[model samples]
Target chain A: MIQISVDEQACNGCGLCVKDCPMNVFEMGSGVSIPRRPENCMGCLSCHEICPAQALEHQGVVPSRRMYISSRVCSMLNRVI
Target chain B: MTKSFIEESQQNFQHDLMFRVEDVPLKCNPPAAELEQTLHGLMQMNGYIIRSLEEIAGRGANAVTFRAGKKFGHEVAKYFQKKDNVEEALRELSYILYGQYSFEPWKPADKDHYIVEENGSTFIYLVFHDCIVRQTLRRIGQEQSGPLCQTLCGYVVGAIEEITGRRAKLEIVHTGPNACLKKVILK
Candidate 1:
């Protein structure tokens, strides 16, 4: 399982990551990208690479995709795997 | 007696002016080294002295934050290595600088590379990252073309340097043609 962590301090609340993500793994809320569906992450790193703030991290036995944003936002896009 | 009175009045005026306004020199524009030097100067002016260069690099942020008072708060700065390694990928560094405009404001439009935002006194968000063009290259492969790589490399390096006044070295970790791997490293 991949653990995605967005650095609150680093995420600037830009919605680019949410827009770039093809899996719909991220969504914009309170000016930040929250992992709406972590399982939906294709591990393509689209969100991770696109994030301007470099605020995403994925830590696990197999690190897949980590998207870090620069702000602390409400997680409104969550859905069960 | 008149001369003495004039001199006293002049002193009183100077003291009053000093109390009324604090003159802080703008040190935003300068080379990386020079900026660090100016930061040191500001610290000394604030009565804190630096002992060595390593100390400056290691804790320069703290010294700067301290001297700027409440006018400036913590801001993040990132650095990258210059090499052609496929393993270590570059990550974007963004953060909010807590405080009012103690330093000059970096306009989001002006910062075409990174997305910069200021939400009142809450924080200033600076978005730093590469876009699809560079990511496409990275995803496709490293040994694709020198011109392409150089251009991409220059963009990423230039963006960070312009923002932080620091130098960075970039490495191309992998070169894949979006097909079967031509070359593979065992690391």
Candidate 2:
């Protein structure tokens, strides 16, 4: 079960997420982006990543654990950060 | 009117280019049963190696996995070099990848929408509706599988290069938990 929310205050209805989503999960309405088909969301995070305003919120979506980042790499990144 | 010799030859060539694994030669000419068993075993080993490498190398594992996938694709192209057309070779390759490697039921994007042709250039669009890598990532609650997807890119590019004797470009156009679309352009 994927839950998607749009921040009307931040979203300018750019529709980038609507265009970027392969599943057609977002729709533009009243100059704002809406999660019209939240049920079809695959939790790919493409919308979240593409939203310039960072106005989209996804809940109940399990984060992917396929990161190949090892502890050594994380330590190095930690030091850099 | 009788068909011209060139037209007849073209038809014959198309017929010969039909996708068939049997057309691919094996180093050891194994029987069908034995070949399937060998492929299954090889895939199992591949999965193990990928997992182990991901665990060992961490961030660098994707490069290794990409190279491995490219090598695998090159090997397949070497075995099936009848026609040098990139589209035909890739279509056949997709059949094998989806039929063999997918852990869940797979549905291909509509063919009419899958291919884009313009100005004598060919672009193939593929959507993996249910990828094993994404499934694994989701199950484990990890946020980064971009590297894993790179393996597919390498494999497709390698196969295209080997088949057409020319390099091709691959782009990950869109990715989702349930679907990802990859675009391969023949250059």
Candidate 3:
């Protein structure tokens, strides 16, 4: 089981994580990002791949925890991805 | 709007942590009781979010507004988060600023100017009219609203003050092709 944590400080309220999660693990409030379906996260790492702010992290997982690029970098890395 | 959003966040996300960075003498600064009146007055002017434990930096200060986590651009690059990404963003941002890279806005008129100051420690993006318009690639997440802008500005200003140990100012010049200005004086 992966424990997902969303860093409020780093989140710029972009809402991309809310959309990228296939499990519907994230929610959007006004402009901020919130974790709604954390349990639903299948460890697919889709949200991890799409997160632009590097705000979301999986704590419980062992070795090689997954991370994602921020939205700002997404614009730059879109071509490579 | 920034102020309102902060309030809403505090009320809604009771579990989440909120931080405010302010530039005031570490100890010489007035106590919260004294600053309350000033903060209250500033609140009336729109877009003010003051949280407890506003880390006060002392003396002359000016620097970059560094933000990490999910919402800011750092998540994308993870440079600051990972040191290497910071170097890369600086390289790209620098190249673009010096007219070396071909990175230009899709709309010629909607040019978003990026400013790198304090030896690349601070990156200031003067996103003008174009930022006000939402992009097709991002529909639900585009930062087009006024409140978000104000909040971003306030947060940046506060963070800059904290990072540099002084008050920071951001000037939003109305240089849009179709722009109108209304001036108000604080008496």
Candidate 4:
């Protein structure tokens, strides 16, 4: 199960989430984004990440995490920390 | 003012972005330090090859990714074929994959992996808190990337074929930014 919430106050009705959602979980309704097919939400954060207004919130286990740091970056961090 | 605004937004974003999964079963293999080291080397080599192919071929990266994954799976099967049954071999392979992913400095600390058997079928579940492929797609503003998932499917299917001598069906049961469930059914 997944939960998607859009902050009405924060949402600018940009429709980025509606367009970016791979599952088509959202729709533009009355100048706001509605989670029309919330059940189909895959928990992919594309919508959340793409939202310029930071209005969409998703709650579910994302299948994989992206944390790529090069060895050069690691060494730099080591020096800094 | 700009910094404060950014900080406030960050705070709000962090407060709202809550993810929870209940009592996920952890099926982990004991560390095989020597074997892990070897697999790590192989993966690094494969990574280099895949990247080189992608560089040369551009859009054909998916094919290279799938072929490399299949070859890697076959190699894993060949290595463990003599010592263990199909299920055990897969479990071991799962461990190696998990280890390889976790060993990366960029991987999320909370990511998890599991292998379970149900109704005479085996399931390998990998939970990625943040998938690189997803991130890449998002970065490029692409709505979907079937090839990325296809690469994984090819690997699992190839491995199953090597072990059982039968092709397995790969199904994506769930997809989320934080979690995706792929099931490999031996057929």
The C-alpha RMSD of each candidate to the native structure, in angstroms, is 21.4, 19.1, 21.6, 16.1
In candidate 2 the C-alpha lDDT for residue B83 amounts to 49
Superior by lDDT: candidate 2 or candidate 3 = 2
lDDT against the true structure, each candidate: 0.39, 0.66, 0.39, 0.59
Q: Estimate each model's TM-score.
A: 0.26, 0.48, 0.23, 0.51
- Per-residue lDDT for B95-151 in model 1, tens only? 222221011212222235222223421122211222222333343333232333333
**Candidate 3's residue-wise lDDT over B146-187, tens digit each?**
333333334434333333333444443222111111111111
Angstrom error of the Cα, residue A71, model 2: value is 30
Candidate 2's C-alpha runs over 4 A off are A1-25, A31-81, B1-60, B101-121
Evaluated against the true structure, the overall lDDT of model 1 is 0.39
| Model 1 segments more than 4 A misplaced | A61-81, B1-187
Chain A agreement with the truth for model 1, given as TM-score: 0.66
Q: Name the candidate that leads on TM-score.
A: 4
Query: Which model, 1 or 4, shows the larger DockQ?
Result: 4
lDDT of 4 by residue, A1-81 (tens): 678899999999999887766557789998999998877665556677778999877777344643322345567999999
Residue B24, candidate 3: Cα error in Å is 79
Q: Which of the numbered candidates is closest to the native, going by highest DockQ?
A: 4
**Model 1: DockQ vs. true structure:** 0.02
